[model samples]
Target: MQLILASKSPRRQELLTLMGVDFKVVLKDVDESYPQNLSPAEVAVFIAEKKARAFDEKIEENAIVLTADTIVCVDGLILGKPEGEEHAFEMLSLLSGRKHEVITGVALLQNQKIHSFYEISEVYFKSLEAADIRKYIEDCKPFDKAGAYGIQEWPGLVAIERINGSYTNVVGLPTHRVYQELQKLK
Candidate 1:
């Protein structure tokens, strides 16, 4: 079956390619807002399923559409993509010298059925200096990333102390889990 990826994230596209999967990127704008009562994982999964369902009427019989949403949660708060430099700085500061969870929720749409799952990875950061945070923000311009940082970028090289789970999940997609789920569908 042909695979369809419904997202605008280049990171997800790159991950699929790295996995040697032949999939086409199909973009659709869906409301990402979730019910406030939902937990972090639920919020991610809800948005992911929402994205997949947007293509429900348009998908071909032989196609499987994959959608995902990644979220950074710390101290019961969800940190979304930063709106500006100050927001990014604030997020980075909050994450410094702390453990946070990066949750990537995935949904697959096929034959009018939706299959969903999530991966949560714990990230530990070293105590960061204010200057370092500013420098990273200025250099990376991570306005498009959840958590205001990319685990594969500058911060990953120096600021991160350790991670407890899938590194790919922190980057965006959970490669191993995604591969397993796709294999099942095949």
Candidate 2:
């Protein structure tokens, strides 16, 4: 079956490649907003499914389309991508010396059928100094990352104390799980 990834995130693309999947990137503008009544996990799944719906009429019988959304949740609050440098700083400050959940929701669409699942990884950050945060913001400029951080980047190398779940989930995709699901689809 032909595989189509419906996202523009480089991290997700890299993870899929590392999983040994030969796929093509198909970009679609998806509305990411969710209802206020949904839980963090629900929100992630909802957005992922929403993205997949964009290809409902376009997917071919022999093509499988994959869509995913990742979010950082702390105390039931969802932290999305940072808007600016100061926002990034604020997000890092909130995450300092705390354990937060990174949830990535994935949807596989083929021939109008959709299967959705989510993976949650717990990430713990060490106590961060203001200077260290500033340096990371200045150097990395992580405006496109959720919670203003990327688990595979410089800030993650220095700030992350430990993780309790799939490391690749924290990076954006749960590669092992994705591979398993893809095999099932085949």
Best by lDDT: 1
Tens digit per residue, CA lDDT, model 2, 86-125: 8898999999999999999999999899999999999999
RMSD of model 1 against the true structure: 0.6
How many clashes in each candidate?
0, 0
* Residue pairs with backbone atoms closer than 3 Å in model 2 (clashes): none
lDDT of 2: 0.92
Instruction: Show model 2 residue runs off by greater than 4 Å.
Output: none
TM-score of each prediction: 0.98, 0.98
Clashing pairs in 1: none
Best by TM-score: 1
Deviation (Å) of 151 in candidate 1: 0.7
